[model samples]
Target: MVNRVEITEAAAAVVARLEAQHGPLMFHQSGGCCDGSAPMCYPAGDFRVGPQDVPLGEIAGCRFYIGAAQFDYWRHTQLIIDVVPGRGSGFSLEAPEGVRFLTRSRVFTDDEVTELAARGEPERAG
Candidate 1:
């Protein structure tokens, strides 16, 4: 059975406002140098949930779709979803769109944690 990702108050506000016009919220993980991970809330039907090759628990009324490639990349991720007031109204639908960055997993590889610490970066909590 699918379970929803924990949502933050800030995230809930964003989701509620968007749901009024669009459909459910959606979050997906992608590979990249920037952000290391990307959390996007897409209009329902804009993308399919997938073939279940990846692990995607639900969050609020949306689904956090983790791609197979991405899931394998961050096998130790403990991601969480939270609501935050969007930049502003109509912000959610603006062209190029608005994506709320949710929290990340607390667990990390020895190399990942070391890299963050070496860079003097704050570690994320579970």
Candidate 2:
């Protein structure tokens, strides 16, 4: 199956460091002004993944989630999480590590869309 999310090598390096410090992690990308648009990372269980979130697979050994509404807007694309060298404007765990998480995306191909449709629950909470 095609993953909805993946991490870049640079981001994975940062994730390794963060994992050594903070242990297991999770990611949530929400939508709104400011920090909401940035992917937020936290120690696993620190952030709640309720029913309104879509499980978009993992990046760097961490599960990635998107708010249901946010997923609606981004569902057609694959999320590629990367690290940029700067403190984030929000409270993601990596924010303290002098790097911020950013997302790059590409629209899915026709076949992936068809597979996703067949899955039917691709956008549902896990």
Per-residue accuracy of model 2 over 12-126 as CA lDDT, tens digit each: 9989999999899999999866767999999999998888988889888898999998899998999999999888787798888888999899999999999988888665674
> Which pairs clash in the backbone of model 2?
none
Off by over 4 Å in 2: none
Angstrom error of the Cα, residue 27, model 1: value is 1.9
Q: Estimate each model's TM-score.
A: 0.58, 0.93
Best by TM-score: 2
Please list the C-alpha lDDT of all candidates, in the order they appear. 0.54, 0.89
Scored by Cα lDDT, where does model 1 land? Answer: 0.54
Candidate 1: worst-modelled 10 consecutive residues by lDDT: 88-97
Model 1 per-residue lDDT tens digits across residues 80-111: 66533333232224222354555555566577
lDDT of 2: 0.89
